[model samples]
Target: MSKMIFINLPVTDLDASTRFYKALGASRNPQFSNENAACMMLCDTIGVMILTHGYYRTFTSRTIADARATSQMLLALTVEARADVDRLVGAGVTAGGRADPNPPQDHGFMWSRSVEDPDGHVWEIFWMDPAAAAGDTTGVDA
Candidate 1:
């Protein structure tokens, strides 16, 4: 069986967060969702679990950092094409997210942009040429 990754996040508004993710192309998994939490599947093997602040605290004793005011962590998602990276960021902004919390990056071989969710979590969307990724920079510009 293939390994799966589930990133758990603390959200102020579960419903809003769920909707935001949905707009960004994630499907909600009803099997593991409820009022206190939601399971948003980014893909077949990757999921994002949106948990209410109260429920999230149950899992850890540490205080939850306010993502908007502090730098917690940066999450990144790689898509198949450069257009897909823009599409995801645009959708996120349309769904109430903040666009380009970080500057967009374009290095000929790779392209990336960032969007901040309603709860202030930033997600970097990127795409890289397969050839460049494989170390074949023969035709890459920079």
Candidate 2:
């Protein structure tokens, strides 16, 4: 079986968060979702579990940081092309997310932009040339 990643997040409103993810193209997995939590599948291998603060607390003893005020981690998703990166970020913004919480990055071979969900979780959308990523600069513009 292929390994999968499930990023668990604390959300104040499960329905809103679920809607936000759906707008960003993630589908809900009903089998693993309930009233207190929703499992949003970003892809076959990546999932985001949005849980209410009370339910999230049951999993760990650590405090749940308010993402709006604190920088926990930057989640990144790669796309096939630069246009795709922009499209995803734009879709996020149209879905009630904030655009470019972090400055946009354009390094010739790679491009990236960020968007913040309503709860302030940052998602970096990026694209990198396959040749450049493989360290092959021949014929590929830097």
Which one is best on TM-score? Answer: 1
Error of 2 at 30 (Å): 0.4
lDDT of 1 by residue, 16-122 (tens): 99989998889999999999999999999999999999999999999999999998799999999899999999999988899999999999899999999999999
The true-structure Cα RMSD of candidate 2 reads 1.2
lDDT of 2 by residue, 1-142 (tens): 8999999999998888887888778999999999999999999999999999999999999999989899989999888878998888888888888999999998888999999987999999899989888999877766
TM-score of 2: 0.94
lDDT of each: 0.95, 0.91
Clashes of each: 0, 0
Give me the displacement of residue 29 in model 2, in angstroms: 0.4
Any runs in candidate 2 off by more than 4 Å, and if so which?
none
Off by over 4 Å in 1: none
